[model samples]
Target: MTRLWIPFITLLSSALFTNAAQASADPLVTIQKKWAQCQYQRSQEKQQIYCFEQLIKRNQQALNSAPTRADLKVWLAINKSSLAGAQGGIGALSLVEEAKDLLEQVIDQAPETLDGSAYTSLGSLYYKVPGWPVGFGDDDKAEHMLKKALAINPNGIDPNYFYGDFLAEDGRKKEAIQYLTRAQKAPPRAERPLADQGRQQEIAAKLKELQ
Candidate 1:
């Protein structure tokens, strides 16, 4: 298994959080900022673990308040998956399992929510988790879900990056480069500087390695 590595902030809309400067009061926006900080800024394993744990609590509270919100469900799923990656072990399996369930619900209820983020995140999970009895990793399913996300948001940075990364990991470097280049040139998210910077660094590193 590759571990559940995926972006916390995928292709999202401004309507989800409103204007960046005025979104400080929005719970989802707060969750997004904290997730970016934890995933990108924090380096220490213990600190990262702590950050994700806190994020999970906050996300859960928000979800409880807005049970019908698919976006909240997606954030909760992301928090759990990120925590699973940080807390690697057999124990992490449960976290990802729950995360998978939550994502499945979002996909069922609103596959296009957050601009197809559920598909992107779910696809990442499928490839990253262990396969067979241990977990549900499946390259075929990963590719399918990733392609679905790409279809919904073809030019989005996260979708292109994820699909490209999937190709690269599968030994299709030439195809990976094409999608990665598009991701590199994808327009920036005005509200997520930290996430954009961090993901760009990751894309650059992957491209460098492939080249």
Candidate 2:
């Protein structure tokens, strides 16, 4: 059986980071800034849920205002899925489904968005959620999509770290360590200081555990 690693510690550890100063005028920018804060600065799950909900509202508004930017869907799904992880109940399952649907569309409509973050996030979701009667978790598909993510972004911190985590959950700790190590060495994201630090911490914990 694959071990359950919450997506918050892995999947959402790499959210968008933008200049807060730039956010004052743009709604999407504001949403992205808050998204990073919700995931990185705020340690509490409930706070994350609240921040995401507020961001989702802004996202929906942005979607209505500027329908051409399909990229917003990616973050919308991510926050919902992150919220799902925070809420440990049957309701959380629905949020996962909603996220799944949104990601599937985002990949089809905008695979190139966010350097293929949709694929990376969706791939992680597959490995994190339950399969068959429960949800849509699948190790095999997780490998495929994760590889696709790497192809799009070989040096991306999120993809590398989650691929390592997937391998670790699948009992390939040795191989997992390889990816985790790379992720730990990944270059800093200028926009997302907090998210980078959080991921580095998670990577350190995972590396130590595996080593």
- Can you list the residue pairs that collide in candidate 2? none
Worst 10 residues of 1 by lDDT: 6-15
Instruction: Give the per-residue lDDT of model 2 (tens digit) for 100-122.
Output: 89888978888868888888888
CA displacement after TM-score superposition, residue 175 of candidate 1 (Å): 0.5
**Superposed Cα deviation of residue 126, candidate 2 (Å):** 0.2
The number of the candidate with the highest TM-score is 1
lDDT of 2 at 158: 90
TM-score of each: 0.92, 0.88
Question: Model 1: which residue pairs collide?
Answer: none
lDDT of prediction 2? 0.77
